[model samples]
Target: MPGWEDRARIGWGPGAAPTTTVQVEACPAASAPAAWSVYTGGTWVASPACVPLVIRSEGQQVEVRLAIGAACGENN
Candidate 1:
């Protein structure tokens, strides 16, 4: 299991275009699996990837769903 709280950081680098650069960081654990993707027209797609989920579109908006599972030990 994770700690008392989970954290997420969103930022863009200096000297970079705002829309062109985005950063996401999760605390305790750096990344999680991207559970799904949502686009316009109420469309939903299954997208699975390790996080710091990055979008490269200039002005397109998207909804990303993420699932962070608890950290399990040898106890099962």
Candidate 2:
């Protein structure tokens, strides 16, 4: 199974643009996935399975959300 690093916090707000770099471990297990995505503004952005995401501008401060599940068409 692939292991993921701890989540890194990045402050975001007006005039505050931060970019973070994350490393994704490689795993070749049936239960291990290799890709994920981040959601913002009702849209999904493809991202590394184990990487810190960059946030620019805190819009509405709604909340930072992440969804970890099977890829497009992989049965759980």
For residues 1-76, write the lDDT of model 2, one tens digit per residue. 1122233223233433332332323345668776554322221234423232333443532323334331432222
Worst 10 residues of 1 by lDDT: 40-49
Model 1 RMSD vs true structure: 16.9
Clashing pairs in 2: none
Give the runs in model 1 whose Cα sits over 4 Å from its true position: 1-6, 10-56, 70-76
TM-scores, all models, native as reference: 0.22, 0.17
- Cα distance off (Å), candidate 1, residue 12: 11
Residue 33 in candidate 2 has what lDDT? Answer: 70
lDDT of each: 0.33, 0.33
